[model samples]
Target: MNKILLSVLLIFCGTSVFSQDTLLTILEEELEREFKVLSKAEVPVYYMDYRVEDETALTITSSFGSLMDESNARMRVLQPTLRVGNYKLDNTRELANYYGGGYFGANQAQYLPINNNSKAIKQVLWRVTDFAYNNAKERFQEVKNSDIKNEIDDFSKEKPTKYYEPPALGSLDESYWKNTAKKLSAQFLGDSKIISGTVTISGSFSRKYFVSSEGASVVQNFNFIQVFVSGEVVNEDGEIASLYNSYTASNEKGLPSFDTLMAETKSLVENLQKLKEAPFAEPYTGPAILHPRVSAVFFHEIFGHRIEGHRLKSEQDGQTFKEKVGSQILPDFISIYSDPTLKNVEGIELSGNYKVDDQGIESRRVEIVKNGKLQNFLMSRSPIEQFSNSNGHGRSQIGADPVARQSNLIIETTSNISDDKLRKQLIEECKKQNKPYGYYFEDVTGGFTQTSRYATNAFNIMPTLVYRVYADGRPDELVKGVDLIGTPLAMFAEIMQAGKSIDVFNGICGAESGNIPVSAVAPAILVRRIETQKKPIVDIKAEEPILASPLLNKKN
Candidate 1:
């Protein structure tokens, strides 16, 4: 079988005679046995694969000087997939309807033993593989009976990949982390304006074992360490405002020190205090500058999702860029690409980096756009017109089918200027448009987009911190309740310029596949004309607690 041993040293997790690599051997053996038997069937199993992930996670949280909770969890999930019929037409094909062609099916993940017990593992795999095979046969019949027909192939032919990386174990000092959370959360204590404050730290590690009938075997491992601090406050007008900041790393050593965490928590509290008293913004449309972090998220939501290969195949999708290929989508100076092979930008670790996608395909860099022209879409094993192969973009959570998703989406520009120059351009553009002032989007929490044909193909970016840059040369004014809203094509045309400093935004993206880690990198950008709307106000008076906190009520 196709396997790469990390080392000769024996690795043990639980009470079992088998080592970690032994698990992959067992998986390959079971896959061969099942495929041999199923290939003889009348319909036949054209393709089959297994993805098993062993995950161990821990969470520590604190609020207002008190430990809220501490917990640890572990589990193993197995996702089995078998396709009936050939690559041209398979059980996974989408059925066309009046609205459009789109279908999502779940393969109910099976739980397996945590220990490396070959016997127990095989038993679980045997049951799931049989179930999946029968389901594939039934779906294949449905596809054959569909009234609509399409020339696009149901799946793409990809060369089998054999790759492996040594498993990385997780180490946690519970006591140290628990105390860190408590200290960080205490930063907001004794502040009367604050309504809520919380600090949390989480770490997770997963070891994945994959095997396919086409001679593909891959075993990889990843880990995440995150520290999050958030705070909320109420203003005199009874409008409540909240803000948050987070730090992420791949390993425990990469996590920030206690001093850094404390300083960040302090800054988060101060920002929330200012946000509470900031004036509520009104709807406006004019020039604006998006901070590097904000710009990264802007592209991720507005442009990145539309370029996913599967979306172009689905009739239900807007297919915004499907026909726009070879056409100018952004300014000639701007270009875009997604690289899962990028582990870090500078020294910051990217959460989206991976050695191999869930499909057992080796990850590679995909240049999606060049010189402002649409070049390609992020592809998976599913083939669309023109693009017949996967570029290792297929990804999914533990229990879902793999789909084309973004990794490290990097937006670059040929013409770059300093942040000062970008801001000056924003003011000049605002004056040219005959506006009194423009806005600066400093940071964002997160945002979403709609790519389906049934909806308006629009995007809304929720910015937590915003500033009104005055054209009259006055000090920038902080403001609240501003949301960056616009359509994809219209918004892409408004780019005026970009800054020299590049920033990174790392977060999780949830879609048809599931929630997977992702990152976006871009420099600050100036938009010639953009729109904004007001966020809903929370009536703090109605929601205010009737009593003070016990910790504060106690006499000194």
Candidate 2:
């Protein structure tokens, strides 16, 4: 009886200790197991990352029954990934050479068949380890048969010390988000005279714990808030005009005040009224000035996308800056950089702030162009021949593969020219070119670019608000129906000057994988020459007006 009791006590004590281990501790133990397996298998190169992400979100939406629908949700995901390369069985030179080439790999979802408990995470890890070992073994055999020696030798280069700790959790308050929506809605209805509308405010907080077999352990936290307000207006022409304003922030205090947002909405309504009277512009090629907001779109669509490292390696990409490294790409007065470390610009917290990138690399600034000279390209873990390591720009949405992406792009100008001076110079250039007027792009909606080498290598920058600055000192004319179009190389060559005052634009950019928040800070820029094509317009005949709701019409 005594011997049985002692055995039972020992078993119970061991179980309790294992159960009490923190999630981080358990994750480390799993990594150790993976390392041991790799050594036993004699894999030449291997990498394994185990991560657990805990996410909480509060969302509010518009509904008929309930003016606002508010709900909270929490979820956790365990992701374990593994890669193996260069396995050789024999000492033969040819076999060794064949195994040296880098291995191509794919990610497999490790499902936990067990219930949603902490121990389930361990099961997920086990699944990934088993899959990776089996896959590597199969791939090694294939490499031996191919006898591709030179390629295998190239795969053994190990890069070093690019890891970064995760950022701290910023402040977040659910009440604040809820109240912001309520306040913005009330202001729009009461002050802006918006008849019907909807507002959605959402907050997301995520915590990620990562452990790798290469002795890397990190924990990161992030919080974000987004507010969206949309409204509709029926004009005198019986056409409905819709306006949307969105706000995003990593820190709560950085969001605009309720009154400020209300004022902007009121102005937006006023602009929609003017848009009804705005005339469509004819296609013209002339000197133009892109205001900061418009200029941001220009840089992002034309320049930023082309410099992503992955695009350069693809045979389809134009590789605009590849051969222009030592040459000037922009005017001598302008310099451009993309940095993720910057959290704020002129007191506003930018949305792109993150401590570590998706690939566990530390975020760093990449200066693509300095003083008009082509410099460097944004990099991620996937190495190209020229660029080997990540500059902390690798990013992706949840469940998507991380890739090289832009963060906060800053365009700095060395010139001391004022906005008015830039416009005046544009008019002079127009006169010199014998054109009646130049264009001033005041604001933008968004734009797209084509980076493929097979195509025309052009970009279309859509402008929402544009004006013609007459060379003969005529009144500025508001016009629509124009889209800024040009090639990257030609556009960069035409940059004449930049303005003194800086403007900041915050928004999200959608690419192949997903949408990610980004910001652009720049001053108004003057380009001596640019090209534009007329946007296609609809020629709809007159139709009956869609009446407003009875309740709203009665109030009006």
Which structure among the candidates has the greatest TM-score?
A: 1
| Candidate 2: residue pairs that collide | 97-149, 98-148, 98-149, 100-152, 100-153, 101-151, 101-152, 316-453
Q: What lDDT would each prediction earn against the true structure?
A: 0.86, 0.68
RMSD of each: 4.3, 9.6
| Model 1 score (lDDT) | 0.86
Q: Give a tens-digit lDDT track for model 2, residues 196-288.
A: 466787777777666666555556677888877766544344444445677778766767887787787667656655665777678788899
Off by over 4 Å in 1: 1-20, 97-101, 537-542, 554-556
lDDT of 1 at 186: 91
Candidate 1, 202: how far from true, in Å?
Answer: 0.9
C-alpha RMSD between model 2 and the true structure: 9.6
Q: How accurate locally is residue 132 in candidate 2, as Cα lDDT from 0 to 100?
A: 60
Q: Give each model's clash number.
A: 0, 8
**TM-scores, all models, native as reference:** 0.94, 0.81
In model 2, how large is the Cα lDDT of residue 499? 88
**What is the total number of backbone clashes in candidate 1?**
0
Error of 1 at 365 (Å): 0.7
